[model samples]
Target: YKETLSGPTRLISIDGADHTFGSIPWQEELFSNTLEFILANLS
Candidate 1:
């Protein structure tokens, strides 16, 4: 994601088989994965 972006716009790319979607549903995993990645670098 780019910080210079404004408004409600968003973008991302996902690797379907990387995390075993068979176990984690893609819909719920969408923001979960992004949230974790973003928070990891917050500090």
Candidate 2:
């Protein structure tokens, strides 16, 4: 999430996830919560 670091634009904390919204474990709730941050801040 930092531009100063030399790497692609990254979303912090959520990485190496084997189970996301559409993944095998199907963590839609986690994804929804994470996504709500965007909506709340933006709104």
Put down candidate 2 lDDT per residue, 9-43, tens digits, no spaces: 22343464423424644444645565676668778
For model 1, residues 1-43, the per-residue Cα lDDT tens digits are 3441222232233353435444658644665666566667676
lDDT score of residue 1 within candidate 1: 35
Q: Give Cα distance to truth, residue 30, candidate 2, Å.
A: 0.7
Per-residue lDDT value at 24 in model 2: 40
Task: Tell me, by lDDT, which candidate is best.
Answer: 1
Off by over 4 Å in 1: 1-24
Report the number of backbone clashes for model 1.
0
lDDT of 2 at 22: 48
The TM-score between candidate 2 and the true structure equals: 0.37
**Candidate 1 TM-score, C-alpha based:** 0.37
Please provide the root mean square deviation of candidate 1 (C-alpha atoms, Å).
9.4
lDDT for predicted candidate 1 compared with the true structure = 0.47
